[model samples]
Target: MQERIPRRTLLAGLGAGLVLPAAARAGDLAAAGWASARGGEGGRTLRVTTLAPDGPGSFRAAVEAAGPRKVVFDVVGVIDLGRKSIRIREPFLTVAGETAPSPGITFIRGGIQVESHDVVLRHLRVRAGRDGAPDRSGWEVDGITCWKAHDVIVDHCSIAWATDENLSASGPRFDGGDTVEAWRQGTSRRITFSNNIVSEGLSHASHVKGEHSKGTLIHDNATEVLIVGNLYAHNLERNQLFKGAVHAVSVNNLVYDPGTRAMHYALNAPEWEGRAWQVGQLALVGNVIKGGASTRPDLPFLIVEGQGDLDLYARDNRAAYADGRPMPELRVLPTTPLPKVRRLARPPLWPKGLKALPASAVEASVLATAGARPWDRDAIDLRVLRQVKDGTGRVIDDEKEVGGYPK
Candidate 1:
């Protein structure tokens, strides 16, 4: 008779061999140009300049020169204040017959481009030229772009002001044509972006393209994003009007402010279709939002707009209005456990010596967080489920149930 390998036993065997001592694995991975799996110390740090002889252009050259593997851009404390104002001499010539408008900076030719892996961009300030043009045109070049890269990090950078709302001479009416053409195309994955500021950068007047921009984490862009505490303000018109497919995770992010009028609004316009088809499950928790002063408003603390069914789980969110009037309806739902759906019917075996456990293991764990087991009833917060008239309502105890809380 063949020996029956217990599932747990098989898992332990697979998981055992791959577990390497942290120090040894760290050294090996580091030498191989891979990030330290254990987040170890003693790694090489490469610094590159983003301006001047060793500026953004030079930085690109340096990356090509240094070759890839465990590199850091070290862009902290780099500011370009030399060019006080970027004046467009022939503004009238660009837009003939119409009123000539002044834009601060102009990128007539090639824009900025970047290609690297495991990169970090920090502490850089990019703004509109100080000519006081009606439109604050900052950098005429294509905005900071990353191409064919993975595990990239963009932090503490500021991008604001741009040339024409619409790049074409036709003006802002026909979708900011000039602005639309400015975006660069590339493939990026596993990106972590935080504490950066972006404001007045892309004009609301431009038309946008590219449908494959995916897998991004946009958070803590408070300064130029304008709202406050990682809020996303400005570009409301363009954000609302854009139609593209973006797969991203937005968490603990503020979307608006009170002094600026209302509290919160959708990141995208209702007309736009972002992540319409391939939107993954979104987890929105602990978000605070306020609505505009308008009598009829569309402001919601959490708005997941797009196609496809979204298994969205929102908890501990506050949504209030400016008016003293009481809220008519607050749409809150009870936590419901999702049915298990495996990406692959059969579990993939771990590489030899890799872990192999019951296929349902991770799923069972995730379901617990969603209030799955009978014991989870005590853990579920009723405040997030139903709105009761009084804090202490009558407690009804019937036959004990064996499912999600409140069963």
Candidate 2:
């Protein structure tokens, strides 16, 4: 946390999130960090599953074959697990779903769990069937859960119908009677949640939370998360939840058909009571949110209710209601004047990279390119994808969209 400065000091450029060398960064630092996510490059490629027991055979077998070394495995067929899930424990692993034989790996039941560092998941589709309790207990399933994990990227996949959350990156809890130290949960750091379709989740579409044991939530411990260029749809609440984060960036994303709330940014000092992230260096720019037809009927565009102080900044984010009318600026309570941009992704994810397209363009691209490949856009109703044009005068459609594995 940065030390507080008097209003006069801020006028002289001495505020917490305001004092920065103007020439330190060039162009969009958030976009560069997001583009530099390369998973399992040093590992050997092992082809697995799809009917005929080919090269490395089953997904589990190939991962075990890699042993402790970083391995890149191409899932070449459909894996129909009845009520099970696969957890990748090895660090530096990549699961390329584009290599799958047909529509990519479709989990009629199971899901993928990356509990390791330097991991990447792309070009896959996970469908958690209805009545989402695999254990026959209360619904608490996630399409992908990165617990106590770091240096990961989840991209170009379509995940749907999770009872709890579709995607989540949370630290494990530190046991201490009832209440536990949030910072002491785990050393989970340097993760990117981007370029994927996380929709139809019963709870939060995505959860970027830390370990909250008792009633008191601690977000001062979660750090270095980059969320970019993805489509969030049909979630019960929090299409994108920024409960607590030390240094987080959300850019060029679209939220369609929101259920409860669209997004939240709560940054205060010390402890942010109920959320799970610490607000260190925050950058929230170029986000598009909409629902209904000319009205955003979910909750609010974003909720800024916490008071724990940290470097906070938000800009270029627009929202529309269900009636398709433009919504007003966000309401940030105990409002601190909008801060300036600062680069926190040092040695960025992509030192020489690019950002996702603009939200107007991203909405069409996400819907067109999301889901498995070989999908007939002519078959599905175009209205389902939120095909709306923006001020840029570009028709939102499947013209330059990109996702999934190329045939």
Q: What would the TM-scores of all predictions be?
A: 0.40, 0.67
Candidate models: Cα lDDT each: 0.26, 0.50
Model 1 — which ten-residue stretch has the worst lDDT? Answer: 91-100
Relative to the true structure, candidate 2 reaches a TM of 0.67
Report the number of the highest-lDDT candidate: 2
Query: In candidate 2, which residue ranges exceed 4 Å CA deviation?
Result: 1-38, 50-56, 64-77, 131-136, 173-185, 203-220, 267-280, 293-298, 332-356, 371-407
Clashes of 1: 16
| lDDT for residue 204 in candidate 1, whole number 0-100 | 22
- Residue lDDT tens for model 1, 200-289: 323321213211111112211110111111222222222111112222333333322222221221223233223123223333333333
List ranges where model 1 is wrong by over 4 Å: 1-64, 68-114, 128-142, 162-186, 202-229, 237-247, 257-279, 290-296, 302-306, 319-407
